[model samples]
Target: MFKFTLKRFGYMLLTLFIASSITFMLIHAMPGDPLAVAARKLPEQIKANYYAKYGLNKPLLTQYGLFVKNAVKGDLGQSLASPGRDITETIMKHAPISARIGGQGLILGVTIGILLGIVAAFKRGKWPDYLVMFIAIVGISVPSFVVASLLQFFFTVKLTWLPTTGWGEFKHTILPTIALSLSPIATYARYMRANCLDVIGQDYIITAKAKGVSNVSLVFKHVIRNAILPAITLLGPQVAGIFTGSFVVESIFSIPGLGQYFVSAITDRDYTMIMGQSIFVSALFIVALFLVDIIYGLVDPRIRVSSGKR
Candidate 1:
């Protein structure tokens, strides 16, 4: 287990490095200057001073090196769009909002999804199963942005049951949370249903049933325990995706989250903001995957053994 964990940690570091490097190169390669729009009316001397201050006048390789060095020291530099605003500070201020919404969405979605799947599997071929499957299909097919729009129209505009947009009270979060959760709900339901069906059909399950094991005991002790493993594998990536916030969802709902800033940064050519956000999200995703790998080993020791051997 120790060896497996160490190996995964090393891989995480390597992946983060590669991701940051790619982000830096790609942002630099993009057309238009980060300061061009804002500084266009300035004198040549002032423009030169501005470029020098931000190290935009430096060569790409030098800037990349400085970025890596500063990032290592926990300094992500300033936002080009909002001059003098520290990128790291911006993240610190906004990340909690995104986390709150994402966390609620993930918990609500996964819990409902797992329950729906279990019911469907237990009532295979019945109306319950059909209904669950139908919900899953529709949820999966519809994009979160579209879901957000419909939710806004129905709940806020038409029904007046929820606020249209903003971030303050609990009511503000409900619509966005639901929008974010639908796809995850759909995803987990399918995975859980499939895994549950497979587990139910196993010879061990059949033998236990033949011995007249209580349905509740059989499900808790045998069915869910074994069936939930695959879902655990999916949890890491799902958490990363949701926790980082959805670009379109944040935009549509006008939530002040890191995702919203990220979108605007792209259009405004805020190089540091873009790089900072990309690195932060990539690191989060890598760390989540690392934790999942460790969890996978703990849940199934055979995985640790196999991984260690390799």
Candidate 2:
């Protein structure tokens, strides 16, 4: 297990390095300079000074090396869009909002999805099963942005139950959370249902039933524990995906989160902000994948035993 964890950590670091390099190269390759974007009307000399000030005048490779060095030292540099603000501090300020919404959505979606899946599996071919499947299909089919728009219109504009947009207050979180969670809920439900159905057919399940195990105990203890393992595998990557994807949701709702800044960073050609966010998100995703691997070993003793033998 220790060796496995160490190997995964090394892979995570390597992945982050490759991701950062690609992002840096790609951003530099794009048309339109950050200086031009940041200071459109400034005189050429002033722009040149700004370029020198931010080390934008340096060679691309030199800039990249500096970026990597500074990043290693926990300095992500300043935002081109905001001028004086540190990219790390900016990310810190906005990440919590995204985290709050994403966290709530994940928990809500997973809980409801697991419950629905259990019911559907237990009552396979019945009305409850059909209903759950139907909902799952709709949830999967509908795009999150469309869901957000409809939710905003009906709940905020027409019904006036929730605010139209903006962060702050519990009411503001509901629409966005529901919108973000819909697809995940559908995905988890489908996977869990399939896993549960497969588990039900396994020899141990039948043996437990034949041994006169109570229905509830049999389902919860034996069935859910084994069945939910696959779903657990999805949770880590899903967490990173949720936070990254929340940009669109945040934009629609006018929420003050990293997503909003991420979008602006692209359009404004804020190179530092873009690179910083890219590295941060990439690191987050890689770490999540690493943690997921560790979690797999923890949840399934088979993996640990297999690793040990190897």
Candidate 3:
């Protein structure tokens, strides 16, 4: 297990390096210059000074090398969009907001999805199954942005139950959390239902039943354990998704989160901010995947055995 973890960690580092390199190169390759965008109306001399100050005057290769070096030291440099702000600091400040909303959304979605899926699987062809499936389909079919809008309109605009936008009190979190949760809830429900069905039909489940195991014991001890394994795999990516924040959801709701910064960084041609966010998000995803792999070993001994052999 230790060796397997080390191997996965190495792979994660390699993945981050490649992903960061690609992002750096692509942003530099884009047509518009950050300096040009920042100093559209400023004189050429001032622009030159700004370029020198930010190392924008340096060759692309030199900049890339410097960025990688500093990144290794945990310095992501300054944000071009927000002058005087460190990119790392900016991300740190905003990420918590995204994490809060996204975490709630994930928890809510996962809990509801698993329960509904269990009901559907247990009931099989009953009306309850049909209703759960229908809701899941609707959740999957609808986009998050649309869900955000509808939620805002109904809960905030019409009912005045929640604030329309901005993050502050607990009331502000409700709409956005629900909006963000919809797709995930739907996805989890479908996946859970399928996994539960497959687990139920397995020979072990039949054996348990034949042995006169209680229904609750059969489910809680065996069915849920096996059925939920796949969902554990999904959690890594889901955590990454939540931490990175949703651009559309943040934008529509006017939440001051990483997603808002990410969008603005692109539009304003904030090179450092863009690169910083990209690398940060990529690292999150890689780390999440790595953790998921470790979890697989813990959840199923077969995985640990295979990993050790490899």
Best by lDDT: 1
Error of 3 at 243 (Å): 4.2
What are the clashing pairs of model 2? none
lDDT of each: 0.89, 0.89, 0.88
Tens-place lDDT per residue, model 2, 8-30, is 78988898899999999999999
Q: How accurate is candidate 3 locally (lDDT)?
A: 0.88
Stretches of candidate 1 above 4 Å error?
243-245
Q: Candidate 3 has what TM-score?
A: 0.95
* Between candidates 1 and 2, the TM-score winner: 1
Cα lDDT for residue 308, candidate 3: 77
For lDDT, candidate 1 versus 3, the one ahead is: 1
Task: Give the clash count for each candidate.
Answer: 0, 0, 0
User: Model 2 residue 237 lDDT?
Assistant: 79
* Model 1 lDDT per residue over 1-310, tens place: 7888899999999999999999899989998788988899999999999999899999999999999999999999998888889999998999888888887888888999999899999999999999999999999899988999999999988999998989899999999989989988888888899999999999999999999999999999999988988898888888788755476888888888888788888888888998998898888888888898998888889999988877
